[model samples]
Target chain A: MPTIVVDVMPKAELLDPQGKAVTGALSRLGVDAFSAVRIGKRFELTVEGEVDDDVLATARRIADEILSNAVIEDVVAVEVVE
Target chain B: MPTIVVDVMPKAELLDPQGKAVTGALSRLGVDAFSAVRIGKRFELTVEGEVDDDVLATARRIADEILSNAVIEDVVAVEVVE
Candidate 1:
């Protein structure tokens, strides 16, 4: 099985309220060694059969078109992992 | 900088409505080669300075206690990436 992982996060320039909120909670919970916290969507897709360039392309297309909003967010990384 | 990526997913026995919805949308949009679709969370945390075992442990603790629900979900993977 081929697993496609799409990690989506807000653009670096934009302020992430969710991340900030999490950071605040982390501080309250006492794990504040983090300089920054980024919260985003990580969509994992498992494709049946062989994993190839076409699958990679489809994953990219889905990540770009369906997964993350290109305007304010960026699909920072997309890859196939074992 | 050390970045810890935590991938959280629902237990295999659990039903994932979000994943199913996405699968349905994919079927409608025409890209359905998936045997099973599971939706979960990926948390990206940035710790200041060096990334090490302590960081990894903290990441695990956070993933287990903070990011995911122990009852229904599982932290499938955790790693420190460059």
Candidate 2:
């Protein structure tokens, strides 16, 4: 089955404290080169039926309506392997 | 150009508090069906050179070495829309 992954972020456009904390930890771990780190989310969904354009459309609609808060956050799709 | 997205999570197999917070908010937002929501990260990295197999290999190496905490977190590569 093809999994549908969703990455949702806060819409307020403010600095993500959680992300910063993680990034700080990473910097301590010796990855200090990157300037900033923004944390979001990852959702893997298993589509029961076929993987088609219609499914994608429905998924996009759902993302817009319920999965993501467009005003404060952004949603991106991560493709599944197999 | 293609973007390389990295999702890093906690490694120790414990409950993710940040994820739980987001899930609670999502449930309040009327998405009560999905039992849980685990928050990770979404990183958009622009590969400076080329989008080739070698680059992917290097990126995966970097993910393993610095980006993801293999002990507790899982790393998944999301394809970029180019």
Candidate 3:
């Protein structure tokens, strides 16, 4: 079965406390290659059958409506994987 | 600054209750194109300089050791994004 992947990330303007905490932890652990860290979500939706236009459209709609919160997060990508 | 995106997903054998709930909700809403849904995490690490081999290595290490739990999750990808 094909799968649709949806990537959702917090708005760029908003503050990500979880990311900040991870950044601080990295610095404390002596991993300084990264300056900032932002966390997001990745959803894998398993399709029932072939990935057609209607399936892709449904995935997009779900990505925007249910997978992510529009006010704080954005649907960055919606791609199909075998 | 370049960003390294790390994708972490729940272990395939684990039962994902959250995903199950969402799947149920989707079916109840009349969206049945998908059969299963799995949730994961996406971490964006902002590098202070160019993404070199060493930076990529560090990101991979973090993705495995810090970003995700070995017992419950797997690091699926670590790619550089602009």
Candidate 4:
């Protein structure tokens, strides 16, 4: 089974409050090497059947419409890990 | 600056309701190749300074403590993408 890994990140123009909060917390934790931290979502999908062209298209559609918000996020397939 | 990527996923023994929901939705959407779907978190961190042992150690600590729940989620540093 192919495990499609989809990465969904907040658009660059949008302010990521969660990321900012994480950075601040990290700074307080004495790990002061990060200038910025962007938090995003990753989905690992194990399709039961062979991943054909149709499956790929469906995955793309899922990423864009279901997994992420098109307006606030940019969904990209990072890879097929397995 | 080096960008460190941390991936956090729910433990295998734990039931992932979100993943299950996604799988159901996919099946309903006519993309019935999935046995399961695992949703996780990805963090992209641009450390301001060089990534030394201390930085790495801190990153590990951050992953273990802040980024994920050690009991429920398994956190791993998947890559150091530039």
Candidate 5:
């Protein structure tokens, strides 16, 4: 079955405490190649049948409506994978 | 500066309660196109300088060791992005 992938990330303007904590951890651990770290969510929706136009549109709708919180997060990508 | 994106996904054998809850929510909302849903993590690491081989290697190593748990999660991808 084909799968639709949705990528959601926190708004760039918002502060990501989780990412900051990880960045601090990395700094303490002597990994300084990275200056900043941001975390996001990746969702994989498995389709029951072929991924057609309707299914893709439905996925997009759900991604924007149900999967992600519009105020804090943005749906970055919606792609299909075999 | 470039960014290294690392994707981490939970093990397929394990039961994902959050994913199950979302699946149920979708079903109740009359969205039946998807059969299953899995949630994962995406990390964006901002590099201080250019993304070289060493930086890529470090990103992969940190992805496996710190970004994800070996027992429950797998590092699916570690790629550089602009």
Candidate 6:
């Protein structure tokens, strides 16, 4: 089976309060070297078919429609793992 | 070069309100097929060294110490992409 992982993050236009909160917490936790945090959704999907163009296309469409808030966020990437 | 991705999720014990909110929105958006949402942190790191056992180990330690909240969450996986 091929696993498809989607990472959805807030668009640059929107203020990511959640990410900002996490980033502040991380700073206190000693990850102070990195200054910002961008929180996103990661979906791990196990599809029961060969990983091909068609499957990838379907996954991309799904990501655009249901997995992401296109108005405020974007799908960063869709990765395939076997 | 190889990229290392880390997935950090809340421990089963902690309540994931963000995930719950997302799940609710997904259901409203017609993904009624699934019922829950689980949010996690995905880090994409481009490392300087070759992707080997030593690198992976170092990466794992980093995840445990800095990337993940060991007190409440866990590092589910560390994936290497070439």
Ranking by lDDT: 3, 5, 4, 1, 6, 2
Off by over 4 Å in 5: none
Q: Where does candidate 3 stray beyond 4 Å? A: none
**What's the CA error at residue B48 for candidate 1, in Å?**
1.3
lDDT of 5 by residue, B20-71 (tens): 9999999999999999999999999999878989999999999999999999
Clashes in predicted model 5: 0
- lDDT of all predictions: 0.82, 0.61, 0.95, 0.83, 0.95, 0.70
Could you give the fnat of all candidates in order? 0.68, 0.28, 0.97, 0.90, 0.91, 0.14
* Model 4 whole-model lDDT (C-alpha atoms): 0.83
Clashing pairs in 5: none
- Taking the tens digit of each residue's C-alpha lDDT, what string does model 5 give over A1-82? 8989999999999999999999999999999999999999999999997999999999999999999999999999999998
In every candidate, how many clashes are there?
Answer: 0, 5, 0, 2, 0, 0
Residue B66 of model 4: what lDDT? 88
Name the better of 3 and 4 by lDDT.
3
Candidate 1 structure quality by residue, lDDT tens digits, B1-82: 7788888888888888888888788878888765556677767788898887787888888889988899999998888778
Provide per-model DockQ scores: 0.68, 0.27, 0.95, 0.80, 0.92, 0.21
Worst 10-residue lDDT window for candidate 6 chain B reads: B30-39
Top-DockQ structure, candidate number: 3
What's the CA error at residue B64 for candidate 5, in Å?
0.5
Q: Which residue pairs come into collision in candidate 4?
A: A33-B48, A48-B33
Give the TM-score (vs. native) of candidate 6. 0.61
Stretches of candidate 1 above 4 Å error? none
lDDT of 2 by residue, B1-82 (tens): 4656676655436788866775676557664434554556666545554567765665566577766777778776645446
- Model 3 chain B, poorest ten-residue lDDT window? B15-24
Please provide TM-scores, in order, for all candidate models, with all chains considered together: 0.90, 0.58, 0.98, 0.90, 0.98, 0.61
Residue A49 in candidate 1 has what lDDT?
Answer: 87
Q: Which scores greater on lDDT, model 3 or model 6?
A: 3
RMSD of each: 1.7, 5.3, 0.7, 1.7, 0.7, 5.3
